[model samples]
Target: MLGFFFALPNALPADTRAKMPGMFQRTINLGLDLQGGAHMLLEVDLTSVLEQALENEKETIRQEFREADRLRTETIRVDSENDAVIVRLRDAADSDRAFALLRDLSKPVDPTSISQDKTTRVEKLSEKDFRVTITEANIADIQKRTIAQSMNVLRRRIDPQGTTEMTIAPEGDDRILLQIPGAKNVDDIKSVINKTANLSFNMVRKESNNEAAMELARRPGSLSKVPPGAAFYPEEQGGGLIVERRTKITGECLKTSSEGLHPEGNYPIVNFTFNIRCARLFGDLTQKNIGQRFAVVLDGVIITAPRINGAITGGSGFIEGSFTLESARELSLLLNAGALPAKLVIVEERTVGPGLGQDSINAGKIASMIGLAGVGLFMWLSYGLRFGTIANIALTTNIILIAGALSLMGSTLTLPGIAGIILTIGMAVDANVLIFERIREEAHLGRPPVNAIETGYRRSLAPILDANITTLIAAVTLYFVGSGPVRGFAVTLAIGIVMSVFTAVVVARLITATWLRRKRPKTLPI
Candidate 1:
């Protein structure tokens, strides 16, 4: 009865559902095959994962050699062609020491394994020079982790509540299978998933802000080398700014983010707050760099380069760019969920239409009525009118309970789910059939109607429970092992089985007991 109340909301119109409580607002979500939606095959950039690892290692080498040995930044350069970092020491005598340092920093390719293959392979390029290349095992491990993280991040960004029934799974070595049901706009979703959202604040090179330097940076083929720990990031407005690659605070420090409008301009902006630890860090960073300017970089592009006139002790800030209302909301949504591990390139994109058209759905409804009517008619003919009427009522109640449970659980409904519902209708009466046959046998032995009904129910209980329990186990197994439509079928079928038992044993028995008590029939109807 409680479930029936919950199921009632699904029948209401959208306007009515909105007026009801949140608990009753959920209707069964239709899958991509039933409702038009976006479909995408995203290929994870495994190479970008490797490149990212190399960038981190490059930073480590730059910091160590620059501080410890006073080595010039220009001496250490990334060997992009060879996929390695090349370091040149000022003193030839420090060669052995630097090699030892590199070896010490190198970790096992897989920390869980003792395979002896190290992540970094350091070799002497020349006297006072060494090359550090990432091992194949480490590259593969990084790629695998990227795919896993990408799937999780995508799930959180697209379907945080887990009710959208979006499918995000590994497709191949370096690809993700993505399907968003009822998502009308493909481009919008693509934008949400594609952003790396790696936000950071870095100090700008004071000299780079000058007109001559700014013009030089803007030239198409200037061929200027960026400073060791700094890169030229293009500002949102027009020019470029050379900013430090390292940051004291990163996007990982953010606790929450929301979309808001700029106070003065009323332009859309993303407001962010940091956790306690990062709050103090932000305070100290701004306090220390009060006279200098810092660049807010997102995915390597400088969004804003505002001078720190005063310290921001509050640990909160807003991100502003050329953002529309929709984009700002999307940005905030991504920030709250967290950044993607690597890039996702949409290699395949399309919109899927419903598998069953409106006419086909109408036909299905008609066919369902005919089938149910036939089943009810057979039950009425086989058993007497009173008992068959009770069985049909129980069957009807079982379906309502199934739908109610499904709505409450927020499971997606598909063609396979509808098939499961039809299957439930046929199986709903199996318990009644068993009990009825037993009652007929009891009547043949000259038992009274009351005694026969009691004996039949008591004896049939064990077998009915045994059969339902075993079938329930199989349905659960299917749910666990399957994906997509198979899981949909399993979900509906399992819920139906449980509801069938309730209506059969609990509901049918109650009605029959009351009728038997009031009427006080002497002879068995069968």
Candidate 2:
């Protein structure tokens, strides 16, 4: 009865399922192979993460030097190819002082290993030039930490509500494996993950002349020559714009975001609010730069650059662009989930259609029915009607118990799992066969029916336990060492092994004992 209630949800209609009690509504979940879904392999762009870190380090160096009155440099640049920061001192005499200051600025390798470990080693290229190369150990550590953080963020973004049975796990040092069951739209999930969603506001760099702006735009390689503290980002609406690299506000300050319609244009937009501290800072920024153009940058593209008409002190704002309703909602969802630490590239994508899944499920059902029928016929024919009927009853109970256990545990059922179930049916009957043959031997020895049955079960206990335990151990090992479909097979095999033991030994014994008490026959049915 408990098994029936537990397995009831799978056969009920959607509306009927909702009407059922929660305890009776639990059902076994289907795997990607059974129900169809999306499979995605994403690789994190670790190089981009390193480059961003280098940029931050460069900014820190500039700020530290600016605060120090005596330190002076011609230019501070990050050499990505060489993986080092170059500090060109204006005067050769200042090299020693600059190196000492910069060395202090570099992070300590370890607080305990101050003397032995240093994050950066300063090398004097020439009297006026010094290079600080970051340690390889530090870079590797950053990559490891970034990948872990990226995996966590990806999981949160993909399964925000946590209702879906999805698998999001790290594949390698820089890759993520995603298997989402019942996910119909692969592109939707991909788009959410691919967007870094890093939002920032920066003031547009005012050019001295149109020729300078056009020249910088024409020569993409001349981005390094844009200015001392500015970046070149192409505008979403038009050509390009040179913007201040220093962020006035970032998405970290954002409290919440939602999709909404633009007040004036009625187009889709993302409405956002900031915390008190950021709201005050934003108000001050807009107040000071009323006539200056402020660029809203997402990832690297300039979404919009509009002049600040007046001070925005409401602590809220809206972003308007060429966004449809769905796009606006997606952007809001990404913003609400927080931004990814690094960009994710979809290296592989596979969409399993529901039709294929249905076909596989049908084939599995047909195979399972055939196996069950064949096993049942052999069991009944070999053992006469009385004992054969007892084994059949135990077999039926075993199936129900397997389904009930799976439903209760919320495990997924795959095609391989169905095969495990079929295998379990054969194994269950094998145990009964051993016990029945023992009973027949004891009956031939002139033992009474009840005594023969008792002795047969007692003697068969060791062998039954030995066989099931060995199989269970193998199933457990497979579960721990394998993945995906292999794991599914292991889970079902393990569960079926346990349930088969119960039905074969305890359940069948109970049925035979009840029959013996009712009809005290002089001879055994076998």
Candidate 3:
């Protein structure tokens, strides 16, 4: 009686064969392939590689200058546009000596080729001034490795998706090529990776005096932005810029974040909660600086610079940007997704028509109906009414539980996933047959109804659990090792196994127990 109540939910309504909403509700998730989205292959810029290598060489050049102590005559500068380092003599008398130092400094660098240009000019007092310009050759050395690092960063940045099936790796020297399926909006993804969201906080410096500007530019701690030339424009909201050292707490530490109206009641805001560490730091910062403005900077721009009116030790804070409701929600998703490993560059894109998605849904539904009908009919014909009906009940439970499990796990169920569910229906009935046959044998031996039922189940328990346990082990292994669609199959199989056991052993036993208690029939049916 109890089992019937439980089992009834699994059975389909007689006329329509549709599931009850409250009994089993499921939403199908579409795969990238079936849904028709963009596939991407992105490569990182390799020129940044050359610049970094040159910067390293600059440090070496500085050391050599310090060692010689003759730099009252020479200056070293990296060209803003090109990846070249220039060493020039300031005093005409030190030209030859400075050239000697330049050679020594550049000796460690494996320059492929070297060339020099000489020029002479008459000084103000009519003295001849001569200078030598040399160009080093090892410009192309770092290209391959730089691209490799960029590919790695891209891989790291994209890891938040937790997609093992998608490939993002290096191709060859100076190129990174790989594919991610089902991702629409290639431009959006490209924007994420291409935008170097490097942020920093630096104290504002006075720009009044030339000497001060020079001194500030020379400071080891201060980073200077180049003045606008023909190619670039001046900073709109200007002051100082250095890479913002991230807060001890980042968006990653957040547990849950949502968009809402600000408590002060003016504009849209994003409310976020962080773990213990973030909360402690945020609370302290808010408490101590009750009136000072702390900038809420993202990517680079100072989006919000609200005053710290009070402490916020609770690990919750509002990101009140110039965000509309939609943008606020989108930002919330990005923060919730955690930070990307590097940046993402979308090298591919496409969109699927609604017609195609609808076609897939129809095909999947028809296939499911056919598979269910075939399985149900076969069970009835093979086992006869009483036994077959119980097996069908168990099969029905298997489907319900699979749907419920999918919902709980937050997995999207695509067409391949639906195929897995249909497969599970056939597989779920095997255990019930094993137990039923064991009971039939006991009843045929002329044992009393109660003794036969108990004995049959007792004997069947070990084999049934062992069989399902072994299958479960395989299912779990596949779930971890296999990619997208295979994983769906594994999940359905594993869930069906557990649910099959419950419905077959527990539900069937309850029905049998009720019958034995009511009628106490002596003759066996099967």
Candidate 4:
């Protein structure tokens, strides 16, 4: 009963057991271990991750400590090696107060506990000195968010998705690993991932008001105001961002989108549906300002700024620009992928080719079919048809759960990943065999059928968990260390082990329980 409860959650649900209207379970995906293709390892550049974080935080810090500058000019510099921000005053008059502020920033580390000299503020500061250190927690957060965002963004950048299988996940505290089985045009991925993806909405600076612009510009970080009814267009890779008005609407308003042609001409356009919340905001903005042009900017460039013909209360609109069909599709994908919590830097990249990925898929399929057939035949030969059929039924359920899980995760199955699935299939029955053998032994020892079947499952629980845990450790370690297909193999294998444990222990037990209740057998076949 304990084992059944423990494993039940992992098993396939009643509804999932039903295959698609016509398709069968045997025809599913196979990963790259059995199929061969490109296998490459990628590491996220944490150096860049920390640098971006520092760059973003630099201005905020200056704002916070701006008052302290009254005593002397002070600046905060990030020391990447030590992962600490060093604050220095132009002169010694503010050093004491600087240290006091530093104390306030320090949470767990007490500044007074450290040795200090009367001559100079603590000679050196380590990562422990900072309030928020770029340790695993910080790195983990950046890694996870980056990977998830990158997945959606990259998928968007690629149109008419092909037979490419790739896995992206956190490799370590500050690194991400990407694996592609048939990756060929790796440079395409590089181009996609290397972008900073920094987006902003600011009032465009007008050249006619050079004096005001220069004054605002000279204010160091101040943004310039746009001339009334005028727009600013900066050249390629221009110095900074400028907009006419604060964006009344952003990408968040977009609920659904589709690519289409503009009504007036051949130019590409993106039609979008906005949520009710945004619909109200947009309606008010458009209704209030009928003649204003709203800039549709992406990244930093002004993509389009259509004039408000009238108040749009329908919650649907189109973005018209001098875009081609391809560009329009890509734009729609970016909008659909959603906004990022923080800007992302591409530290790694890879691309899988359809040709290579297809070949790998074929190989993986052959290997999986071979593995399944071998396991099924062996089980039938070793055990009688009755018991063997039941084991195969559980194995089928295990595979379904794995497939459903992969689909749910939106995970791409690679070649080595297919090998993992095959290995899982072979090993999944070990628990079932253990339980069956235990039942047989009990039957031979003259125990009643009901007691023997229940006892078999109850006793096998501990050994099952112990065996799977050891393998899980190896799988997790390989997932961290090895790249590409290796990680794919690890992911599928780990998932399979979990699914197998459930189907073998719980699903098989349920079937046996139902059978025992129905038959009420007096003598059991050993």
Off by over 4 Å in 3: 1-196, 205-234, 237-341, 348-354
**What TM-score does each of the candidates earn?**
0.84, 0.76, 0.55, 0.53
Across 1-526, the per-residue lDDT of candidate 1 in tens digits comes to 6888889987899999999889988887777767768889999887777887888899988877667654443377788899999888778877777888888889888778869888889999887788999988888888888899889889988886676888777887999988888887777688788778888888888768566456655772453556567777877777788777877688889999999999999989989999999999889988988889988888878888888998898989898888899888878888887889888889999887665434435665676677689889989999979889999999989888988988898888876787788888898899999888998999899888988999998999999999999999999999888877788889989998998888888899999999998999887665
> lDDT per model, in order?
0.83, 0.85, 0.58, 0.63
lDDT per residue (tens digit) for residues 34-98 in model 2: 88999989898888888887787788788788788877889999999997889898888887788
Report the alpha-carbon TM-score of model 4 versus the true structure.
0.53
lDDT of 3 by residue, 161-189 (tens): 57433444454444455444466565665
Q: Which stretches of candidate 2 lie over 4 Å from their true place?
A: 37-43, 90-175, 178-194, 203-225, 234-249, 252-255, 261-268, 273-295, 304-317, 320-324, 338-355, 381-384, 408-410, 429-470, 520-526
Query: Best-fitting candidate, measured by TM-score?
Result: 1
Query: How displaced is residue 77 in candidate 4, in Å?
Result: 10
Ranking by TM-score: 1, 2, 3, 4
- Residue 525 of model 4 has an lDDT of 51
Question: What local lDDT does model 4 show for residue 440?
Answer: 87
Report model 3's TM-score to 2 decimal places.
Answer: 0.55
